[model samples]
Target: MKDRHWRTRYRVGAYEVWGTSLDSEERRRNAPHAEPADFGLYLDERWHGEEDARTSHFVYWPTLEAPVERALLIARIKEAAAALRDGATVEVACFGGHGRTGTVLCCLDVILRGTTAREALERIRREYCRYAVGSAGLENFLLNDTGDLVTPEPLRAGEGR
Candidate 1:
């Protein structure tokens, strides 16, 4: 909490994904004439802040809980991934940046890397923060609910099912 606003949580493709907490973002916003922080596109997963202009999309996700609307969350994560692929710096965060923030970051990883939810969770924990996906239930939800987020591998020439 010591004036640190953002941290590079992990990478998706060639983009460096950043993470922050609502408190930190508020700090950045309230400071007078602070250079606009390069939080290019925000995938806000906090329970509040629906009116935040910087938020590309807001999901009312509670701390240490699984996303209530899995489909919508996946779609938003896809949008964020698309923005990242197009050279935008994407930031994902919730109230604390460890629970819900980490959950969404895992989903983004699933979509971008075609990895299973469990695999994405492992990578996020290893690369971002060890305490990420902060609870057992959240971990289970990430493992089970994100089955739809995995991108299937494309068949190459002469390959048949």
Candidate 2:
């Protein structure tokens, strides 16, 4: 329906992550993935649609508002990362696919790669998009939450424990 904000998939080891925006959903059901992913990992700050709910194992947050819940966000990221390792597809997205989308993608990178937050941010910008993690506040938050290298623990579907 409009210009696409879908981006190339970033891979770490055996898993892959794709970043997208709300507008991109209208034009492609699964342009970035073949035959619709086994599942999705929706990362929109304030947007979730029927398709996402029905087909994705999603996590929601409002990136422009209150800070993201660090523990919960980490759990979700771990879950998605684990799913990816298990041969499932995960698509992380936000309204513009710039800030929140990119931030979460970097988080995934950290968990998967065991890199520092700063390093992940740099990698996201270099390999994904320059506009990624679009706010100083968000950047700071990520740095704080993931200052220590994060090693994501695998989480099962519907299990946040």
For lDDT, the strongest prediction is 2
Could you tell me every candidate's TM-score relative to the true structure? 0.74, 0.75
Give a tens-digit lDDT track for model 2, residues 1-161.
32346645877655778677767764366553544555565666345553342257555566643245666667777777888788777777677777777778888888787777888899888887788887887787778766443645689889886
Candidate 2 residue pairs in backbone clash: none
Per-residue alpha-carbon lDDT of model 1 for 26-95, expressed as tens digits?
5456534433323433434443433233445676554466766677777777778887777666777666
Error of 2 at 154 (Å): 14
RMSD of each candidate relative to the true structure:
3.9, 6.7
Deviation of model 2 at 24, angstroms: 2.5
